[model samples]
Target: MIFAIETAALQTFDGAFADELFLVARILFGGVIAFIGLNHFLNLEEMAGYAEYKGAPAPTLSVGASGVVLVLGGLAVALGAFPTLAAGALAGFLVVATPMMHDFWAVPEDQRQDELNSFLKNVGLLGMTVLLLAVSTVEWPYAVGVGLV
Candidate 1:
């Protein structure tokens, strides 16, 4: 019985540690999104220029919309409010944007490295988003508050 109790206590500690790590990751990732979103608004012209260079249609409008989504979704994720939905939206956006906006595969070999890095980063982000969605469905702030529970 004592051994069982010790094991259970250890498990609880592990769970708490995992939760803390997850929260820290959520904050860092969300902060990056928020920063980039703010940059979109503050550097609207630069964002539009990048969009146009990427051959995106209606560069200005696209920049604006992406900026808004990033800002709102980032905040939602950071606060652990509606995390699942926010993560889903971000994943979807990355799916589309990675190929359309980044297009690392199409670049020259020398220049491709950076683009590939960006592409891989987006892929990782997508994975995180999906994981966050899964966790949100299983946990309190996300499940109960967001109705995923």
Candidate 2:
């Protein structure tokens, strides 16, 4: 009984540590997204230019929509208010934005390497967000299930 208690205590501590790390990462990533989104909103012209460079239609509208998605997604991720949904949304957005906006494949060979790095980073972020969604949902199924009860 005593041994079992000790083991359980250790597990609890480990779980808490893991949760803290997750929270830190989530907040940092979410904050970055939020900042970028705000920049897009604040500098519509600049974002529109970027949109044009990406060959997107209605540059201003595209920029504004992306900005809104980023802001909302970031807020959701930061709060962990609906971790699964938020993370999934972020993952999808990253997937679309990375290839559409970044365009790693179109760069010069030398610059392609750097662009690829950015692309991969965004891909990794998407993966991480997806994993976060899965893990958070699985770990707290009850919370994500009915209501938070």
Candidate 3:
């Protein structure tokens, strides 16, 4: 009886630890994305200028729209509110933004490495967001939300 009780206790602790890890990962991903999205608003003009430089049409409007998407998508993913929609939006954003903004191969050799790094980073973020879309079948313990897979 004593051994059985001890094993149960150990299992409970392990399960709790795993739950905590999931919570932390969700918080971090959401927080970071929100922060980046906020930055877009905070520096709208500068971001627009940069986007314009990169040949984006209606730079100011486009950048603002993108910012809105980021904020909404980031929050949705983070809060586990609408994981599928959020992940899809974010993934789509990355797909377009990565190639359009981080076209390393199209840039001059001197800028190639930097652009490559940026491209890869965006790709990685896209991958994570897409992954969130893949296993979004969770019923969610409550109304609020939970972490990615």
Candidate 4:
């Protein structure tokens, strides 16, 4: 199983169609992440209020900082620039924010399902971040070639 996983992780795409698909996926993924970050700014007051409700320290500052991280990281990923740093920022954000922002178990019964859905969505995104991290050492076929690795 370990070998299979390794093989899969190391697999490379070499065709035009595959390249386009990978590039499109990156753009879509990064676009959505960037949009989500932008949303933090657009909804700052509401998001800060929720953060305060969750007992986050310096809720306003935290939200703004996270928004910057997301915007920068998402753009890097989309542009294929500094993928390792970008992925790290994104993964870090998700790791910390997921539980704090979407703690279904801690929410009231009426909001539990909504929070659970968000938690699950974040988990899926976390999985994608891990995948990007795993491939950060490789030259991305359609990337802008701005990464140190």
Worst 10 residues of 2 by lDDT: 140-149
Higher TM-score: candidate 2 or 3?
A: 3
As a whole number from 0 to 100, the lDDT of residue 39 in candidate 3 is 87
Task: Return the top candidate by TM-score.
Answer: 4
Per-candidate clashes come to 0, 0, 0, 0
Best by lDDT: 4
Query: lDDT ranking from best to worst?
Result: 4, 1, 3, 2
Model 4: residues >4 Å from true position, as ranges? 1-11
Q: What is the model-wide C-alpha lDDT for candidate 3?
A: 0.77
If scored against the real structure, what TM-score would every candidate get?
A: 0.80, 0.75, 0.81, 0.91
| Structure candidate 3, residue pairs in collision | none
Off by more than 4 A, model 2: 1-16, 109-114, 139-149
| lDDT agreement with native, every candidate | 0.78, 0.74, 0.77, 0.90
Candidate 4 lDDT by residue in tens digits, 93-147: 9999999999999989999999999999999999988888988887877798987
Residue pairs clashing in model 2 are none
Error of 4 at 142 (Å): 1.9
Candidate 2 is scored at a TM of: 0.75
TM-score of 4: 0.91
Better of 2 and 3 by lDDT: 3
RMSD of every prediction: 6.5, 7.2, 8.3, 2.4
lDDT per residue for candidate 1 within 3-101, as digits (tens), equals 543432122214556767766777899889888788989999988998999998999999899888888778878777777778887888888888877
What lDDT is obtained when candidate 2 is compared to the true structure? Answer: 0.74
Total residue pair clashes for candidate 3? 0
